[model samples]
Target: MSTNTENTNAATKRVSPTGLDLDKLTDWLAAEHPGMVAGELSATLITGGKSNLTYELTDGTNAWIVRRPPLGTIMATAHDMRREYTMADALRGTDVPVAKMYAYCGDKDVLGADFYIMERIDGVPYRYADELRALGEERTRGLSTELVGTLAKLHSVDPAQVGLGDFGRPEGFLGRQVKRWKQQLDTSKTRELPGVEELHAKLLATVPAKSAAGIVHGDFRLDNVLMGPDDLPAAVIDWEMATLGDPLLDLALMLTYQRRAKIVAGYETTDPANYDVTLAPGYLSTEEIMALYEAESGRKLEGFGFHLGLACFKLAGISEGVRYRHINRQTVGEGFEDSGSTVPLLIELGLESLKEHK
Candidate 1:
């Protein structure tokens, strides 16, 4: 039988979704964080996450977010709840807005995997252009500005000052990142992808010298952040891929997403309905974004072309992994139907990005 069929059959025997054990979780929380729950605990899966599983928990009087690893086999270092919790807790008093962390449970017996809980911030994670279009150009521009500014603010903080000095090794970060993503790509590959191996080889050959180390959000993008009513970033969620590394990598990844948004929106086509949020009127152009970051952080971005090329490679690997999961029926929620189609396009974009760099 296909993996999807096996997974579907397996799910039928389970009480809750893959990684959640609602009743046991409720009991554990009551014992550990008494009075935190006022009634019976219930959970609803929160979609839009492509890595770790996120669930919205409620006790009728309160709401919380629970994050844990996805079901089935996973990379050991990837979906670490402790890492996410530590970073969020460390950034509490800093300028970076993060959800308030409540607890982290490493015992797998509690819910079949490690998990963490945090107070849910009230804001919207704007995923598409339709949401931003309703807000109009002015508000969308303001929101985009806040998004970029928030990232700069995050990179400005000293990791040592935030008690995350030992979080990750920054030395040789760029080289390791190249190898790491290449391995991820190999593991996720289901078929031969033209230009993907060539792009990987090019990225390895052109790894740039490491810049000063700072906290890098490995998957920085619009949908990853929660925007408040004032068009400002309320909280930067999804820190699972965060670590200390070259801050320029973070900037490049954000730009890559911006470029991908355009690609997904069909820049060559006149399909108005295909527009992405990044294509919304008044959103900052690529040049404007670079300038804004430079001005805000007072950091001259040297060797940025190399970083952008590598960003494309990294994102291509990520997209391929998502596509693999979707094909296996291991993905949660809607919108995954077209995920596999983006893989080849992203690989092609990665090659094109490197050519431009040369």
Candidate 2:
């Protein structure tokens, strides 16, 4: 299990991660999952995630991954460990590859926050252009195709068939998404952003009348999926934002991330090591990815501009939150200082997407 993002795996005996207590965790595991622990537990914090804190745990023989919400205050609907665990657990036998869920703990007394444990997959999350380039152009293209194909397969699954019919209120989902991201931006606003307010207004006014309902991976991107040894998506890892909504929004958000990776890599202030895998040679273009998705899912993407605009707006709001955290010194790892700069860029892109798509 490799996370190419800002993660550090430092081995320190008996020293648990910042948010976890070894003694308490050991006790809970013993109570919840009997006979799982072979020896004393040692934990290592994998700190790159902005929303949820991930920790790698080992008990001499067995290794597992634990996820919990970030420290401090969060929105009511944000970082629900039970929701994430349930979604992944439901999608187990489906076309959507997900990690094998072990247990979910909603009792805050266990760890001061809700958390879940799951099998640690040994797949690589390729995050950089150079990393994919190592696999050659053909393999990169195939991986990109596999990524979109997996998304289509996921969208094709009936939520009810997976016992997720009541997972979310899909009605008026698009409108709610726009308002939710706007509220998030307002809550995290640190400085004046020129085009955000206008973009928000335009998205509110241009909400699409028709949308296809399906499970939405709110943050769909290449790095979010783990690639197996054969260069296929072994498991789609991050499920913190998974819910029932307009599936096209997932597509729009994915394309937006592709653009974001390119923009981030082009920045002069960006670290030389940072690169966008989507821009790597032989990677599928935005049109090709969409075409493959439409063909596989048999769903026409009508009024796609609004979805793209909303995706950009959502990304902007998320970036603003990152910037807010970075400014407050609440974020960990590198690249956060550049988050504020991307917000305005995302807003401008959102406005352009609306104009072009319209």
Candidate 3:
């Protein structure tokens, strides 16, 4: 974990030589993964990841990525690396493409916290469908369609059937969202902003019905995926927040990224266009996807209002926590500083979506 609170006055915060330092990192990589013994090894910290510390390591010819918890005190169940590896490894041979996992480490002596190494994906995928428009709108739309279509495939997967029976509760996913995110907000909180508690209370009163529970990628966005040079998605990264939930919530999160409503740190301006990139379209419209999902899974996805509302609430909690980290200067990748106003904006978007629906 890269987050070392050296400036903190706490004793445990003073854990010297936190995690696996690079020298040991090289030795560990050499022993566990094949082909790293003879080649020179280089380790570089990947910043801008808000949650886990990601490292890019190369042993001369071969390269891989290591993901672990941030240094210092961390919530046990939340940042569990074993669980992260479990999800990533589980996706193998499935429709979902993930970077291949090389090994999972639970030994604290190897590094302070648990860590895992996986194959490194090449090239950036289309975080914004517009980023692919370098080809043209029609072609971008085709690629974008594949993305949403792939998402539908993901939502259709049976967590239990796919050998992921240990994933966790799926029966009442939408029901648990608010409580879970609220706890996250409480744990990571470092500052206060207006309307947060009020907004949360309102959400408690306004939660919509659970439509259908399925495998929801807790954090689904374009940037989370990598596209090959062919302009197609090569792999999906960051499975730490994966969960079972109302799949519509995943769609709503995708929408929020489309508009990037939360303000970022360095860029003070709130530009809706930045998020206007419909990274995936033909695959995820409420009508199109619900039709596909219901037909494929034989399940009902009726509670659009509730699902959209939950999405807004989810975004608010995430943005608020991010805003807290931003003020403290703990965030690596910038943007989302104006998360103060994202709640209202998303709620408005939800309301508009509803109006358009009617």
Candidate 4:
């Protein structure tokens, strides 16, 4: 993303609640990229991000986005700002819509963590059913169709062409995922989860043969993308978990999110409210989405049952981690109070998904 470097010496500066140092950031920008600072910086933390902290930064005239690791302990491999920046930068002219990346700062001394800036695109993230409902069923369905099509487009990209051929080891990707998540679950285990171990075992035993490899978003869902005014995707954000892997894994994760949305919408005790946008009229069903991906990518989505089962297992582990942090009071935002309630149900669903395949 290109920045307008007008360089005004205005003295207005404000720090966000997420602890971004505006003065330091402005100074660094002024030194590294002269005239980029139109005025003093003002930042506001963007809520709804569950992993890395996202902030909207504006220098009175120009707007940009800043992403940094979350506060407190983080798994070293999980939130790599450089990796995210590389992916967005590589996909700059590609059909997959991504915000224009401006700069990446690895200097931890600046913000106590690495961060990057990108263009601030205008669009709604469509996190809830009510949001899409306001847009009417036709627009919502069209948006969802675009969403699946976007995934197909991403999977169609050759990693080597984007200079990301070495981004991840696609050989044995599924096995590594199962092992990695199992270790994550072990590390984050606060209490015994009844079905999680069994589910993990099933996933390990039924690891599908890896298909053609491509860039996987790791967590692909409607909320992860920005929907434009015309019902097309303005940009896809949140690439911290992105890597090269089986493309079907991305599709499976999308389906998993659909299931989680439906589950969250039905729970009365969920705090901060939850609603399933995919349940809205016009949105494609999970089966339809898979079919669309198949048609668009021209690939057989065989053994999808295994992929879905693995996706559920992965999500359950993530929920358990949230619950662990919530119980320990380590979580940052709202809606985590009921995170523990999601684990058992996710595990059960995971087991059922595996059973369908078996």
Ranked candidates (lDDT, high to low): 2, 1, 4, 3
Candidate 4 C-alpha lDDT tens digits along 1-358 = 1112222236653324444777678778988888877876787778776667788899799999999987666666878999999998999899999999998999998888999999999988888777877788888889999999999999999999989988998889888888877877887888888977788888888886656688998888898899888888999999988899888888888888888677766765544324667878778988899788889999787777778888887887676666776777655555666675777777887887776533
Q: Which ranges of candidate 4 are over 4 A from the true structure?
A: 1-14, 264-273
TM-score of each: 0.92, 0.93, 0.77, 0.92
Candidate 2 residue pairs in clash (backbone atoms < 3 Å): none
lDDT of 2 at 160: 100
Model 1 per-residue lDDT tens digits across residues 1-358: 0111221225334235556777678779888988888986666778777888898888889999999987656666777889999999999989899999999999899977899999999889987777888888999888888988989999999999989999999998888888888888888888888887788888888876556789998888788899887778889999998899999889888988888778766645646655667887878888899999999988887777778878888887777778788888777666677675666777777777776533
Clashes of each: 0, 0, 10, 5
Report lDDT per candidate.
0.82, 0.84, 0.63, 0.81
Candidate 2 local lDDT, residue 66: 92
Q: Give the number of the best model, judged by lDDT.
A: 2
Model 2 spans > 4 angstroms off: 1-13, 264-272, 333-335
After aligning candidate 3 to the native by TM-score, how far in Å is the CA of 296 from where it should be? 7.1
Residue lDDT tens for model 3, 1-358: 4444223325323222223366556567667765655675555666545677787777677788888875555445566777778777888788887888888988777767788989899957454434655567666655555566667778877788777776777666666787877776677676564455655565566565435667777777666777677767788788877776677777767765554433232244534335434533332444554565456555565545556655666776666556665666655434445544555565455444443321
Candidate 1 is scored at a TM of 0.92
TM-score of 4: 0.92
| List of clashing residue pairs for candidate 4 | 1-100, 1-101, 5-35, 5-36, 141-282
Give the poorly placed runs of model 3, Cα more than 4 Å off.
Answer: 1-20, 30-36, 71-75, 128-130, 190-194, 206-211, 259-276, 279-300, 332-358
Name the 10 consecutive residues with the lowest summed lDDT in model 1: 1-10
Off by over 4 Å in 1: 1-18, 267-274, 355-358
lDDT of 3 at 96: 83
